[model samples]
Target: MSTSLLIMGIGGQELIVIVVILLLLFGGKKIPELMRGLGKGVKEFKDGQKEDSPTEKKTEVEDNK
Candidate 1:
């Protein structure tokens, strides 16, 4: 509910302004590098989550035994 509210609060103009601010702060050359790093970080987090789930299930099974 709160997420929806937050999304709705940002109109097109607001998003454009935010994007313009980001471009000004980071410059064109740096943004791609920043985004690539961010993408890698998110991918690593997802891979960690995938690796974690099977271990958690295995531990649960051991506890039941």
Candidate 2:
């Protein structure tokens, strides 16, 4: 299947419209700050996933024992 099919039928034009709406809503000056916050959120989510991985849990259990 094509990538658009995987995205539930949202194509390139739809993506552009969504980005344009975001830009209009947040304004150009605030977009960078919004993106920076989003980046930090993603980073924190990844870090949390790493901390909760099976290997980390196993190590914690061994340390406790």
Candidate 3:
């Protein structure tokens, strides 16, 4: 299972409930915008992880020494 599902412990019913609540709160039109923003945030986080990987950092430290 994905780390998020493991951490949240949300099952099918709970996920459905959350989706229903989001639809009610944001409506159909705004949901896509929210999802787009979320996708961008996740992409940025992954890019940051790649730039800060341990092996690259180790090599930089060795080069400096």
Candidate 4:
């Protein structure tokens, strides 16, 4: 079996490909707007994830014990 990473971005090529795809899909004028929305969505999701994770509850219980 061979293992390959798909999103490593180790050589900046991953970013280049993503930029090309975004430009093709959204045009240069819209890419920044799309990225701004994407960034907000990611940030909101991360905040929600932190609020819902069981680890936080576990720590609360551990502290009580």
Candidate 5:
């Protein structure tokens, strides 16, 4: 299992340091809000992709045929 940090050329220790820096910069209370926004953005992106999926449109057309 390759970690994304490794793909980005960062090591595990660098990941820890980055997390700690974020915590310090954003503080504990604000981190959850940031994560929540990130989650919502990802969910919205996935939903948008689903809405635009050509395969689903093709399937519907085939069913009507």
Candidate 6:
């Protein structure tokens, strides 16, 4: 028999608990604004990382020459 290691498989109940915890910590009024800011921050960070990848760096050097 195959063995599985995951103890707490995430489901609807887990999501509801997570939402309730967030609501308690940040309150209902702030959740949307916080989530929006978090999304923007993650997007910008990923974009910045992608722009610095090796292929882009090689292109930048070729353009400068």
Top candidate, metric lDDT: 3
- Pairs of residues clashing in candidate 5: none
How do all the candidates rank in terms of lDDT, highest first? 3, 5, 2, 1, 6, 4
Q: After superposition, how far is residue 2 of candidate 1 from its true place, in Å?
A: 15
- lDDT digits (tens) for residues 8-64 of candidate 1: 797667778988999999999999999999999999999899878988889989999
Better of 3 and 4 by lDDT: 3
Once fitted onto the true fold, the runs of candidate 4 whose alpha carbons sit more than 4 angstroms away are 1-18, 58-65
- List model 4 lDDT by residue over 1-65, tens digit each: 11344444244576678778888988988988978999999999999999889999899989999
TM-score of each: 0.71, 0.75, 0.70, 0.53, 0.76, 0.77
- Measured on C-alpha atoms, candidate 5 has an lDDT of 0.93
**lDDT accuracy of residue 5 in candidate 6:** 19
TM match of model 5 to true structure: 0.76
Residue 54 accuracy (lDDT) in model 3: 100
Candidate 5 regions exceeding 4 Å error are 60-65
The residue-by-residue lDDT of candidate 3 on 1-65, one tens digit each, is 56798688987788889999999999999999999999999999999998899998999999999
Better of 4 and 5 by lDDT: 5
* Model 5 Cα lDDT, one tens digit per residue, 6-56: 788998788789999999999999999999999999999999999889999
Mark the regions of model 1 whose C-alpha exceeds 4 Å error after superposition: 1-8, 54-56, 59-65
What are the per-model numbers of colliding residue pairs? 0, 0, 0, 0, 0, 0
Better of 4 and 6 by TM-score: 6
Summing lDDT over every window of 10 consecutive residues in candidate 3, give the lowest-scoring window: 1-10
In order, the Cα lDDT scores of the candidates are 0.89, 0.90, 0.94, 0.81, 0.93, 0.87
Which run of 10 residues does model 6 get worst, by summed lDDT? 1-10
